[model samples]
Target: MIVADLSSRELRRRLSDDGLYLHSGPFICRIQSVLAKVADGLALAYADYPLADADYADFHLRLAAPRLRRWISPQVQFHADVRQPFLPLPQQQAYAMFEWGLNWCVSQHANQYLILHAAVLEKNGRALVLPGHSGAGKSTLCAGLVYGGGWRLLSDELTLIRPADGLIQALPRPVSLKNASIEVIKQLAPGAIFTPTVMDTSKGSVAHAKPPSDSIVRQQECARLAWVAFPRYRAGAALNTQTVSVPQLLMRLAEQAFNYSLHGQDGFSTLLNWAQSAQAFEFEYSDLPQAIAYFEQLASQPHTQLQHEAAPV
Candidate 1:
């Protein structure tokens, strides 16, 4: 059964009792929370995700109010397998805390695959890997592509690369939008659903956009890596893009990887193989529509062989 199949009362009961085993891509997260915001967020954002069995889960997590501070200066704590990794956050931000905490769990423990801090989308069986730092417009462009450009959302935060086959494993979840980008996406896809904007947390006004139902349904499907684009957004800057050499791309991607040092030589080899086979580029743009159009054109092309320039490593 999917999350939508459960009534609000039942959902809350499960959270307050045992837990809700949620299937998100390749991992099963058993979650327990009494916060209304957490329940509401799950109801709206993860309604399409499948329910997992209670026998075993990849991660066990909980968000609950502190004992003494439950009434005064109320805050919520995120518990992961008896360990509280983060300090308490405002009770109003419980849902956002849940989202961030879950990301922490996967990025820290799910080391079976080569995970990168990137946004991934797929089209025509080709996956586009957008690796960028914060405020680099990666999520913004990803949201635009999935909601407005007809691309399928693979993931909005973590990009999982299976080591053996080098194919990207799908982890389609809610796309987190921050500050100004929230409204930008609202205008981009007027019909898209979003959690209520929560103000005054770290990251300045955070919100999450629900992933498309199609993406959630096809969470198990994998896509071949085709393009690695490093996107940067600058106001009033014209679209500028250039091909990047494999070595340069490898070095940059290594920096973006969460556990590149964990797998040692095997990780190096995996990334090297991926970079050698896929095209890489540095893309800079100001306007979202123009950026989307550029990618749409890139997708339509049967073959693209841009000149690669070597840079200082």
Candidate 2:
């Protein structure tokens, strides 16, 4: 049964009791949390995700109040299969912490695939991978594309690429918007659901936008890589898409990968395969509408011979 089948109260009860096993893309995360915000967050953001049976779970996690911290200040600790990996965070930020913690759990432990620090979305079966560091506006642009351009969301944080086939595995999770970007996206997509803002975290004023229900419903769909765009958000900058060489793209992508060296030669081969098959560009833009329009044009263009031609290593 899907999470939507359960009432928020039922979801909370399950979390407090035996835990709630919810499907997230290919993995089932069994969550047990006594913190109310954690339940609220899941109820609001993951209401549409499928709830798995207890017999099948990839990871079991919990968010609970800390012991000593209860006397000093209230805080929450995240536990994966009863093992706590993170220090306690403020009680007010429990939901944000849970979301970040889950992403960390999957990205760090799921080494079966070549994971990259990127935002991925698809349109007409063509997937675009946007890789960037913090403050790069990758999630902002991804939210814009999914809501503003009607692209399907594959993932807003981690991009999982299978080395064997070089196809991107879907992880249609929430889009995180930090600080000013939260308000920016709220205005851009008025209908989108956003968690209440939590201020003064490491990322500063963090909020998560729920992934579109259609994207979550089609989470099993995987697509081949089409374009690798390094997006930079600069104030008042005109829209520019610069062609990046394959070697440079590969080097930059390696720098942003989560487990490039973990897979060794297999990882290198996967990167090579993606670079050879997908177009690469450095995208800089100030105007969100203009940026969306530019991508629309790119998405409409058919794959060309250049996509398959090998570049100098």
Candidate 3:
């Protein structure tokens, strides 16, 4: 049975320039979004939800409104409200940040959390979080992990990380795939469930993969921070681990983090602690099969852990 709750939609009598709609399920705090209208009038509607009761734009009406304020951690305090004046069209960029930023805030307050810019996948005895920027082959890499590598995907976008302690909390959500990665993953993992393609956006025709069944089944299971591999898709770079410096890695991650600095020093320290705790690597490669092999190899070594040791002289 699908459990759900939602909020109130504040409408401007005038049609919005881009016609954007973002809704958060009661069970989930982050906004689920779709640009309602496109330059060509291509529409993306969620009227037909697959589950028992789907989310809508009016969850705040519930007698118990979300404690949105309490949800915002001190380190992650920021303002984003529809009450603010409207902006220009093509709302995907800001909207993407909004949808995920709210999620980062809401997730931080959960018991023991740390939100990560990573893709999480469960393998033999562990879970892997591949955190990287836009061009990083995280989604495509995660696609193979779920399909061929026998791992359950936690998320193809963001993974929750607890700041208090260094636990990689599972914020199991659908995996979003863009243009090229879409066909790649589909060909590799034929059985993967996908939401309808929402066309005419900044990212060009986008879609989401239904979260892996295991993430849904054990929704409460929290995966620890195991591997933090910052991957890059080089056209033909040799499959190798280009060690990402602790400071540099954290720097790159901070730039991409929604609440990295929101948590301020705490956020910085949280990331630092995480980098030192997990196996950190900057993977550069073009072959998906070889990357999978690399993970397989890394997972086989004894003590296989890659914690930070004092830098040698």
- RMSD vs true structure, all candidates: 2.5, 1.4, 9.7
- Which candidate model has the greater TM-score, 2 or 3? 2
Q: Give each model a TM-score.
A: 0.96, 0.97, 0.66
- Candidate 2 per-residue lDDT, tens place, 205-279, comes to 999988899999999999888899999999999998899887788788888899999999899888987777778
What is candidate 3's lDDT per residue for 84-119, written digit by digit as tens? 122322333333334344444444443234455668
Candidate 3 accuracy as lDDT: 0.55
Better-scoring candidate (lDDT), 2 or 3 = 2
lDDT of 1 by residue, 35-109 (tens): 899999999999999999988998999999998897898999999988899999999899999999999999999
How high a TM-score does candidate 1 get? Answer: 0.96
lDDT of each: 0.91, 0.89, 0.55
Better of 1 and 3 by lDDT: 1
Clashes of 3: 17
Q: How close is candidate 2 to the true structure, as a TM-score?
A: 0.97
Alpha-carbon shift of residue 291 in model 1 (angstroms): 1.0
Q: Report the candidate with higher lDDT, 1 versus 2.
A: 1
